[model samples]
Target: MDHTAADDISHQANAWFALFHGGAPTPEQRAAWSAWMAADVRHAQAYAELENLWAASALLLQPSPAAAPVAPARLSRRRFVGLGLAASAAAVTAGAGTLWLNGVDSPFADLRTAVGERRIAYLPDGSTVEMAGHTAMNLDFSATRRAVELLHGQAFFRVRPSAAGEFSINTQAGRLHTREGEFCVSCENDAGLVAVSQGRVQVLTAGQQTELEEGLSLSFSARATGDIQRAELAQMLAWRNGRLVFFNEPLLTVVDALQRWRKGRIFIMDKQLAARRVSLILNLDHPDQMLDVLSRALAVRTTRYTDLVTLIYPA
Candidate 1:
């Protein structure tokens, strides 16, 4: 295809999109539009591509005040990013994902959430587990045992009574052994951040064992407790109510929280932008608005490819 001709088609596609966004057209205009779309195969393809782009930018288009927000339209496109071993090692991926197009189904996953979705699962032992977006967990039970494996992402566990004995949890990072308590664990970078909401849980990483009491949080990295801190347990688990609470955290960390509920992958290409400090409260249900606010506050802009991927770069 000629480069100039392809550009012309794209330009025409954008024009048609503007007309559609402007509102319903007259009969004559609709007929002309139909004729233009049917004029050539390339014309239809070009229009479809532009429609996908518009879908990806759904946040930018707001309807009347009383109308509900529009959902993102799914469309396929060519994958752009190619990360080799070296690049993958250097690029630290960050971002929240949500609004699952397709929920997960696995024999091992007794409880799971699709991308951009969160769910609560009630275990047989009267315990409850709240799963974050893109999270999966498997429950293990026996005459003398109860355990849960955090296969991926994060979850908040409310264990059965201590009279029933200890409940063990396994993640990519380490094991959290607890009883009669509520707590949350998040896995990232081959590590786990355990925040205790009530009662104490013994954390066993490698050969070390320590008790994590209420109001205390610890980060275990690569089978070891590296950094520990105290926090407001209630604030940490605010996502149960569909909100993200952050305080003096790096922009990269914020991105991780946002990825929990937003659909598609969001890439932050600038290291400096990722490292900047941030403090804010974000509503998980309105992820598009969240991204718009972040981009403006961080002096950045997003380049989206349909609804498949979103890339963030300095403006």
Candidate 2:
């Protein structure tokens, strides 16, 4: 109602939220909280407001290693960033407080396609997002944060960085900061891949960060650390140009690329066949045709089921 009342409510709400993160409260503290809950309707309202703040602030709340209360002076920078997000969330919740206290709609919220679907999206910030096959993501941009939540499948991002802002790809593992790069992110629930084709990018997980430059790749798994490996530039990036270039590349890797382009699967009967290096350019448009060309070029026999699946074996 009044400024003092609002400030008090905000302070109490923040305190309670801090307790929630600090760990389970003592029975005495719990009794106090319960008594406070019944003290007045405004107390309940303020507590609910604080819970909204916590949800809006989830992005900032990294788990403390010791599970202890984080002092105000020791609050991480991420918490400060979360403060801005919390304000934004506050704005959205002012009217429809009943609704989840979240930021505006995701950029990829409306992005989808049918089976064997593909669409290209040009973001407002001049970056281009190519949704490969059946992919989805939500795009959210504000003064402080530029982010996209990859819902499923794969998407290649040529991010146009803002001079004064940070662009991040938020997945289950954590946030990836793309400073300047042409990168591809393939996300399937808990496991994901972040490959940088050019420039540089940073992957943030838990409290750790990894910087990946051009020709570098990293795979992230939920509840575990990630592995950083050298990336083959041509094969990792060829999809952008509608071709997959394999210069003495392994057959297995080539088959994996074909799988992404089409719906079916490619099975190699001989494991030694995977060691054989084959140099060829496969057009993504017609995977079956590529198989036929491979068959001719490598003396391999390919058996086909539907247009979506194929198997390659030595002739």
Candidate 3:
């Protein structure tokens, strides 16, 4: 256990896993992998450390540790890749060096989720809120501004707009004004996206204003001066179906979307799966059925280590 070489191998293992989990390995990478495996058990041990680190991180992104678990089944390659990315991102943000155990107290006590989880709530204002996995929202509808803070993840709002009142959904980025109709807004960090499914929404910033009509969508990054990206009709409001709808979206992006509602993770075993195009209606209420359909459609296998964990690989 030489400190210098063990530490070096450990870092290299992390890098290798990053690339390996990222895509198909090159011939050289495959060959080097064999040599590394033969060199010593430490190389394998080091890689295991990285993998364990990532797996632990998936828990942090969950909406709540107490949330129900998804049924055990196989996951798709695309879902697997998606979980890897989510775990990596969480590891970086939550400080990979820290140790966290299950059922530990969390500051996000207000709301949380595992992976691929979903929850619904009845609002004080007679509206309904369906919170996506790994998402949080806080309500502080003050006299000046009716605000629903988008802390993280995503949420769909069916607002009962009052005639004498205006509803404003607030995120770290800014505030959204909602009138008599239904809308949904997702916020992450200093950026947020808004979609109007049935009514109109006026998004207000420091000095700019944009309005979305029914069946339209837009994205706003948390920058002092950021422009908005107009969203397509069906693409923007796809969540209404209790599925993460995508059309030609990157595998990485789609996984991120699905991770929002379930307890189990979706890990990609190979990179080739990432580039393949998939079109399926995901039923959040039936995650297992969704996985089964995905496995057959994509020619992959879903392995469940636990009700809360899953990995996708070539069958």
Between prediction 1 and prediction 3, the one with superior TM-score is 1
For model 2, the run of ten residues with the poorest summed lDDT: 92-101
lDDT of 2 by residue, 1-315 (tens): 897786565556545544554457899988888887788788888778645533432322333366563222333567545643553443221111111112122334666533234578887667888876546677787666677887666778888878637778888766688766798887656777888878898887766788998867898756665678766544455555565556557787666555545544456666677667876665655543566556756888776543323446678
> Which is the winner by lDDT between candidate 1 and candidate 2?
1
- Which order, best to worst by TM-score? 1, 3, 2
* TM-score computed on alpha carbons, candidate 1: 0.69
Mark the 10 consecutive residues where model 1 has the least summed lDDT.
78-87
Candidate 2 or 1, higher TM-score: 1
Query: Model 2, stretches more than 4 Å misplaced?
Result: 1-109, 112-119, 142-144, 172-174, 188-191, 223-231, 274-277
Give all TM-scores, in the order shown: 0.69, 0.54, 0.56
RMSD of 1: 19.2
Residue 157 in model 3: shift from native, Å? Answer: 2.3
Model 3 over residues 1-315: C-alpha lDDT tens digits? 787786567556745665575458899989998798778898888777656644533333334456665555565778766765675564222111112223122345455544455678776667777776566667765445455766676777888876538777777777788766777777766777777768888887667788778756777765653444434434344455454444445454555555554444455555666555654445566654555555654577777755545566667
Candidate of highest lDDT: 1
What's the ranking of the predictions by lDDT, best on top? Answer: 1, 2, 3
Candidate 3: regions farther than 4 A off: 1-122, 142-145, 161-165, 205-208, 224-239, 269-272, 301-304, 307-309, 313-315
| Candidate 2 C-alpha error for residue 78, in Å | 57
